[model samples]
Target: MEEEVENILQKGGELFHPGLSVDCVIFGFHDNQLKVLLLKMKHADKWALPGGFVYKEEEVEHAAVRVLQSRTGLGNIFLRQFHTFGSPSRSDRKLNRELLVSLDLEAHENHWFLQRFITVGYYALVNFSSAVPRPDATSEACAWWDLQDMPPLAMDHNHILQQALETLRKQLNDQPVGYNLLPEKFTMPELQRLYETILGKQLDRRNFQRKMLGYGILDRLEERKRGVAHKAPYLYSFNKEKYAAALQDGLQQGW
Candidate 1:
């Protein structure tokens, strides 16, 4: 453990660019609730999003992907850069001071860790069931928390989360990105529930079905969803081919 800490300190400058970092707001859906991944730091009560410094040679988006993979043990997921936070004082000093003391960082190491960071924010949609939550080297634990019940996050993460959710809401209307949060096969109600979770409102069932099906992005399968309380709804999968074509030609006759 001492060697590990030393190794991290030695490579700190080379492995991470001085002023830039990446913070990922990974959203998942399970048990009818939209969840966000949060990390508990060693000896810290404040929670944080899975975040890391960008390597000197890596692109920002790639760095975000690396951070997400390191924290969650999942990859090849849909990630999109939503915003960049470059406030002169984005890092919280009090939190960093306590964290540095807890980690017993050397003077130079503490200075490096407390430097001003302009973070690129990325939001990802992952299938919750497939995600194996893992803490990064600096964190003690990691878990999913419902968006409404999140713990007080360190830094400006609460603001970042709000921004990511707003971006996701806009994307849901313009893109078929919400399919990333779902299984390969799901019922119309399941899809509706996912949208409701994001939009924070109940969509009219018949109108939602008509509008979603009108996009020609869903492929209705003959298979019916099992383990339901009542009549099993038919399963449907998003058609990649159709979605790709629609992206080129525009959906809903360019409405």
Candidate 2:
């Protein structure tokens, strides 16, 4: 074995390369489609979301961004901290237990493989047009998958992804940031797609439009996509300041 690998085992007790790791469940929307980021783990023959350990001096968020950049080649994208997963079962002993038996290592070190560890989960909202997926040192490759059709994943990654979906829904339901899924300039149907995806229900177009217009968070623009056969819908952008101000006063949009 290599010296670095030797040292890892030397210091390893059941902690299994333990450190403060951040996992990003990156989500993107394009053409009214929803997707999530996933990566293939090296030597594991399994797919997982991109994750990495924090440097000793790195801030929690900085670590997450580093992981994102290192794995996905995406830097400085907006990501939100949602929840932490730290169950004894989550950092599963079964995975480590198999490794321990296969490696012919001392039994004492086996516990280190199974030791409890905490993982902070963050969800990033990426502009599908901007994100360029890349694999990290510990991954073989990376790609985005449709939420409607995801491949099998390792290490509770599917759970993490589900958590992200729930978080996005909560944000849409309460905070109602159409910006999470819509572009800077969007048409009415484009805006509605974002809400429908998050809320997981088909909305009545006329009623929904009436209610959204009443919110007064939309700023109409003169621009419109040219050459469409139908009446080209007018362009509009979110009034972020107005929405934030409303949030301050306890106005919320429930899912």
Tell me, by lDDT, which candidate is best: 1
lDDT score at residue 80, model 1, on the 0-100 scale: 82
Query: lDDT tens string, model 1, 1-255?
Result: 545755665567678888788899999999889999999987577889998877778888888888888777788887989999999878776676665566676545446666777889999999899888998766778999998799999879999999999998987766775566889998999999999998999999999999999888999998999888889999999898987676455464445
What's model 2's TM-score?
0.80
Residues 1-255 of candidate 2 have per-residue lDDT tens digits of 334443554454433336356889988887676888888765576888887666555688887888777655667666878999987667755665554545555546445446666889998877777678987654568888888889988888899889888987876644546655577888888888878876678999998788888777888898886678888998888888986676455344543
C-alpha positional error of residue 135 in candidate 2 after TM-score superposition, expressed in Å: 0.6
Superpose all Cα atoms of candidate 2 onto the true structure and report the RMSD in Å to 1 decimal.
Answer: 4.1
RMSD after Cα superposition, model 1? 2.3
> What is the alpha-carbon lDDT of model 1 when measured against the actual structure?
0.84
